[model samples]
Target: MQRFRYRFDLTSLHFWIVIIIAIISQALKAASVVVPSSNCYVLDNSSRIVDFGSDLVVRFCKDVESRSQTGYVDFGRFDRFNHFVAGSGQVDFVQGFYNGDLVKCEHSYDKLGRTAQVNIICGTCPNGQCKVGVGCICNVTYESTCRVFVELAIQCEKPGPRVFKGFTVGFHPRTWEIVYDGMTQLGFERSHQEFSFATEQTHVYLYMTAIASLSTLVQKPIVKTFPDIGLEVRLSGSGAAGKPPTTLSPTALVVDWRCEKARDTPYEVNITIPVEGYEPIQFTLTKMCEFTQTQDGDATRGWAIFGVLSCIFIILSALFCCGGFIYKTRVQRQHGIDALPGMTILSACLETVSGAGQGYTRAEDINSAFANEASWERPVSAQGTRRQSERKYGAI
Candidate 1:
């Protein structure tokens, strides 16, 4: 079989070029997964209770005198009013309004306890005996048109700045007549079945259901805000549906807000639904602008380090291969083999088999032997012999 020679030159510029190209391509491919503009922000203090309010009421009562068998009785009491108190424990004021002839308000705290309770009482009391004495009687009346005002406090757990895009509010289908008193006061206007407004506050409330029921209402309300507006406000906490009266309803109402970019100023959203069977359900939401570093930045840094390390590894590996190739070639030359053009392993094996039983010698020895053989095969020409004969005759 004919033998073939092959060489592997690791030190060649072409080999290094290929290795570098491969490493660079891999690094570029890894970097392509990250989008510079599409950075993600994590909600740090998620689902924290920012504010809560319950047991709100507005009373309209006047003192009146009554006659009794013993003498006259005077007592203080409420005649006409509107009031509602839902949820207990950690409840605070948000906002409220009552005016004109409206009376009687009731609500249930799905988050606090499942049990239904009368939280609000409005209107004048019926004829009743004064509690001061058995023989005494008292009468309470609402004379002039009165307005009721009830406000609750909201509590935020971790107040900080945040960035959000939009928000969504859920409501019950059956309770579509409940008006959002707090949202109305915040400058929200209702058009048809939708209510929307914007503010600079970061804390809001959602009110739903005057009583607890087995059936729940889930309504989603749209939020309207300037997309370019960025607000810097504090992020307190969030509440979901169901827990204490202060907490959101688990099934009745839900709210979700998404943030795209951070804003320099904060914004607020208020919603109200006027349902038939229940009072208006009102809530408020506050958006805060937060400027915090995200994980994508850190991941980008990690990828850069990894790419650098990979390039270093590839370079070291190429150097090692090239060094080994050079050393092998030098060793072959020292042993007197023709290693300048190098041979493949197969070709070397074939050459060894063909030259088996032959004496090994240096390249110089082989060259000299060929030269001596060529000298022996050369013949003298007739002219040279004739010239030699002539010279001999002359000498004789």
Candidate 2:
């Protein structure tokens, strides 16, 4: 029988060492997963991006009215049919919407990356300290609940890893109020389904009323500006169907207005709908609240003040030049360029050029002497006298 011997090659040993080191490095990195903390009360429907791995991240949101909190974790996106469970808590599925259209969850996973399946876990933590991946919050009067607004979970079929483009979470509490008195004033027999809500960024209202058919005009976005108040509202169809109408005259209209200064100053929302051959319906959804007009007035006043100051400066400069010219010519009896108000500056500028042909240490004085004795200063008859005498001698 042949003798069998085993010897490890040096190259194989080096390769094994490198592989072992990489595995240990990844393990250590996973062991040290640090979850960042944020103020729950301040984040209103905000989201942050996170990396994908065994380690997880946590984001907290709060509702001031209910005195409750919600935590959201972005587990990237899922490609295959996989069950996700929180490491330390329970997770439940959350519903999502697209442009006010409900995105219903389906049992079939054939929607590719078009459908998103998001899971949330709600609980309470001690002293505001909570573990990552588990949706928990502290300093709440009640237990924390998982709530979301417009969160997306796309299922992509691409071969590479999917990117987690952040999502928003928190309750968008929509409140509705009946515009009964206003509708009665507008002479509408049956006007209902009109309400409004305000946020820091925008103030939105929805107005719905029955009217005659508008002949294919329901798919356009209608925008009206109230220049007097520095505000505008864009009207679109409420998505009773999956798609919202791009324009006006839809069955339902959602009015979106920008009220960035809503808290600082009051705002008014006035909506009007006209029919082809029927009485126009009007809705004064909000009380007449004046937008602060002082800013524009202040701007106008500032520009006016700047114009006055500029005019005064120009007048003073002209007066100084005229006075200097009059004083130099009349009182000092100066003539030629010296009598001009700006002659000093002009002479200093031309000093180098005028004295270039003359050899002198002080160029300005030498040029002035040459100007005083120039041939042009002599009378025309005296200037030709020397030349005429030379011609007479030559003729003799």
Candidate 3:
């Protein structure tokens, strides 16, 4: 009986190289993580208070005749000087001397609070009656002249008039204008008064407030309106308008107000800031909430990195295979085996088996050949004897 044996070359460097490359490919595929974030939009720039005015108007009374303790006297028409009054159902007015001339003023009432008011009466006594036994009567029409002047010296604080979370405000250095972010400007109004000034016979007191419009930054259009959110704004400076004297201080002033409710349609906020010695300012801010946000890794970059690694690995694998083949071929050549061109390792192995079979000789076949040699020698000797006997018989 013949025994068969087989051996595996587990120690081959080429075998282990292939296993290492496969493990590396898997590790690169499992590397990324997910993250979260919010979406937002910002106001492009700050809103500035370019120009402002206190609308002033003056009205004078004429055709005056009165009876005094000096008895009945006729005084020709003369203008009456009176102080400007505001917030009074009576005409808003101011009294002062301009250029050494007494100036009595009254302004048209603005629902927006843009002007001051003063009242004046003018007319004549009915039927020239200078006295209703004592008092005088007039049936005259009133006349008013309007004038305007600009005033400055105003400052507003954070979360002004209206406050909202995540909202911030600032001032521009160059323009000294109000700056804000994450909000949009809508419009403004001016209607609060601060103080009065007397200059060279001209008595001037400004009654005005500034308003600005703004809204929150919205990335997309709202499908529907949300509930209203309330906010507050507080302001304080050297001369703040529309505030009580008790509330006025050198320090900051705060006022709380509700933000216009959020809605599908846009809404405007009107801010009213008063001026005393500085430029008046006003603007509107709108709040909008309608958009989605998400956070994630850069998928493209991650995949690109992974792909690059995979390509490198593939190239390395090719190089390793090539190096192993070359090494094997060289070793086979050194051992005097003919290495065929373009022959793979498997083909070389099959050829080696075929050659081994052709070179194999059985021990039994060799012993049988040696046993047949003696029989082959007897045939030659017998042939020679028969030839000699045939020669003798022919001689007899």
Candidate 4:
């Protein structure tokens, strides 16, 4: 019993270990964990104003990963930029980063806590230009009296009006302008949308929640955008009302977005980030969920695992029951108990006693014990009384 109990404890430990291992394996295979998605946006250049407002579709694709975590990831970078201009006159437009991205950013002193990432500019500009080529720059250039300016604005549905703010690197305030924030004494200037930028460096803040003190009051802001929104890139030629259009929206700084994971997503914003001295380019960033997902693969794996476990259980149960029965029968036989059935039972009894009782064969014992010798001797006792009496176990 002590040995059996010890064995049973060991078996129980093994069983628990197997269960834990199975559970972990299944969890890993499930791909149900919440992870960052792979969603991106295509800058696809900027489309100019031709028919009041030109229609443009931003082509996007979801790069699905091949694994069990099929469709559960979100987050991507802007990738391509292609612009089309088909206007006979100059157009008006505005372009800037989406405000939704800015407000959702969590700011803290710890670098690890920040979820946003800033891509460093490549050292090789290809051309002899600086911030105007790769970094965010807005170039607004219009004819004679029409002044152009690059502006940054953030919109949150918070209290206090509509929560609007814009920052500029060029031009002065108009008193009651939509947003009154800008860099320098008179804002920044346009350096043309080309590799040869001639504008001075100006640091303008773009609605970043960077203050550690404001962390308590500023939660993530709600941002909404319409990808189908179209803006007219109004441009007036210096000559006449009807003239060939010039590609003003510079291609020097075209930003695009793309999704790298397998998941569906939707457009988070639609903004026209304008280049300095160039037309305001219109573009949209959408969110889509379409990364590769599992097709009952987890369930299939579970079935396979269960099948193997069940077979092992059945085999063990059969072995244990058979072993117990054989052991019990062996013990009973040593205690002189009948273990055989039918004719074999009688034979088994005779053989067992014959081994103990020496000089007594099974057939001789049966014959001499039940023969007429005892019965014949019993008749002599009856003759004394002139009586006939016979019995199998008669005493003389």
Candidate 5:
């Protein structure tokens, strides 16, 4: 029994020793972890964190695998302008940095405080020897490569009135490209790619708050309609009129109240932001104003002038008809068609056409007028021959 107890005690001690060793191994592995996955990496060696305000922060780290010839890590040499200095064989990463070299660096919320990286930029080391902070280390050549710059992407849940604070350079994650804040995202670039920018406040706030500061600086109005309430408004692009924005800020915009034609009616404002390789961002905005607005100028004035002219013309026509009827019946003693104003004028026109320029005369006197003509007189001999012929006919 004593021999069996000694063996059991020995086995138990060995098992505890093995368990402690495994725990120590895991802790050491975590402390020096480098690249866990292709999409993510850690700055475990000689890391330096640079906080550029709340919008962006960069962590410059030495390559974990690099065996630095010098005792210290190389963060790369920078000029006064915060640009990387390149040797003869090395390419420039500052001038055309947006074309490439900008990697996505996202700081996630976790207990480990790990920042995941989507892409990596490697630079060839100057000498054949490897340096820790030059960039990602390459195995083929003892030389090292490093990530020179990083980018952060920010997207707004609701694009409200963004004021033009100034110009800024930012990156687009979907397009995997970098651009200026005012640069148009066209073609494949129109993907609702996030653009890095700073707001008036360091923390999240309500929308349209920037308009208050920009209102005093605005010189012109976007829409012609006069609203019952006037509030400062801003937008990403120019006004709805296609005119340029009043302020120098590219995002500074003027609210176009004329979005819908129907007035005094409630409606939803549908906004669509396209996203490539994914679903688009869509939301609706409700009007804040209580009353609807119409265009300026009294529309009824034009119609009023027209109505007055019409009434005057109608009254004059009635008066003319009444006066003509009374004169024809009482003063002229006319009857039948002649007593009617319209018929009298129509008959006069017909008489003028039938008389061929001769003045008006009775229809029965037409024959008398023809007999009095000089051309109607016959010769004396022709008249005597006609009388002899008549006497012969009578004798028969």
Candidate 6:
């Protein structure tokens, strides 16, 4: 009889093994789903390529106001205008603009004094912290809030030796005085609709009434400049759409400036927009950067691997089934199950004995009381064994 062999395959084991491998690979592929965020600066694409010179932008703007020309100048708050005129006081509009009236040549002379024509420059000055050319301070308090200004210092480069006129004091700012009032000037007790921003866009439009600038080419930002050019800026801090970048640069903040590399050098354009908080709006930012395609080939590979493993598993299972069938068929053929049929030897012997000895017996004494027929079934050994012996060694 053929015997079943387990050496060729274990089908259940093969199927489970393939299944486990597929799951592990799929889990790893699923982990690649995080998006990282970054900030970008966008500038005016049209006009930002021009050369920056004087009567041009300063790195900073200092506001000088006249408290009193004769009083001790508050070297602290710029209450005294003369000190704000800076070391290059002989030059006009160097650190800031001159707004006060000039006086004619003073005749009064001290021991070593030769009378000099005295001129005054006023209107505004940064709080006394003044640098000759790099930047200035902003400490003018008007109507409860501070006015914003630029950091690029405006130096006097014109040909004449000019002296600044003194400042005009008191807060009755002229119709023109209210100009650089920043966005915080706009009441904050209001709501607005959602604004849209792209992943790496370069330009951002903010809603604030002030002057602020961020440049890609320049290091320091310019804030609160001319009020005639009204602007409003919203940063992520305000719970608005725009945000200043905290990483990547220390003082170089990420605002709404976009960098373009049209020429060999990069041109940066920064724009601050004007708006109230009640409307829905979206802005555009342009930038030059790299992008990645998100589609991955791993999933297709997973399917392919699964297919191969499944095919192997199926082939192994078929071989197992075929082996089992062949083994069972061989066992049945060798054992000859058809050869064993059950039979009663007594009946077959009786047929062959030709009524092997019809016999009559005397009745028992118990017949005197009541008749009792003697009945018996002969053992299968008796007649059938006699027939078999006759076939083998002649009748006994």
Write down the TM-score of every candidate. 0.24, 0.24, 0.21, 0.17, 0.22, 0.17
The lDDT per prediction is 0.33, 0.34, 0.30, 0.29, 0.32, 0.28
Error of 6 at 345 (Å): 38
Kindly give the stretch of ten consecutive residues in candidate 6 with the minimal lDDT sum.
Answer: 161-170
Query: lDDT tens string, model 4, 1-396?
Result: 999999999999999999999998765332111101221111111321122122222211332323223353332222224122111212222222111111223232322221212221212223333333323322223221111222211111111111111222111222211112211111112111221111111111122211232222222222223332221112222211212112221011111223233332332332232223222222222334244323345789999999999889766765665566566667768887534422233443444433443333454434433343344566665544532233222233
Give the alpha carbon lDDT tens digit for every residue of 144-181 in model 5.
13223332222112212221221111221112112112
Question: In model 5, which range of ten residues has the least summed lDDT?
Answer: 201-210
- Give Cα distance to truth, residue 245, candidate 4, Å: 48
Q: Model 6 off-target regions past 4 Å?
A: 1-307, 322-327, 330-396
Clash pairs, model 2 backbone: 113-155, 116-153, 219-247, 220-246, 220-247, 221-246, 221-247
Candidate 2's displacement at residue 309, Å, is: 3.8
Worst 10 residues of 4 by lDDT: 156-165
Clashes of each: 65, 7, 54, 66, 7, 48
Q: What is the lDDT of residue 104 in candidate 4?
A: 22
Using alpha carbons, what is the TM-score of model 2?
0.24
Compared to the true structure, candidate 6 yields what TM-score? Answer: 0.17
- Name the TM-score of candidate 4: 0.17
Task: Give the Å error, residue 332, model 4.
Answer: 6.1
Q: Per-residue lDDT of 1-396 in model 1, one digit per residue for the tens?
A: 122222345346678999999998765322211111211111222211222123223232432322122343222122223222223332221222322222121122222111112221111112322232212212322322232222212122242222111122234322322222112222223222223323322233443432333113322333434443443222222224232221233223444343446655544544433222222334344455454223444799999999999889766765665566567778878998555334333233343344442444345533433344354445657445533533211123
Across 158-198, the per-residue lDDT of candidate 6 in tens digits comes to 22111111111111222111112211111111111122223
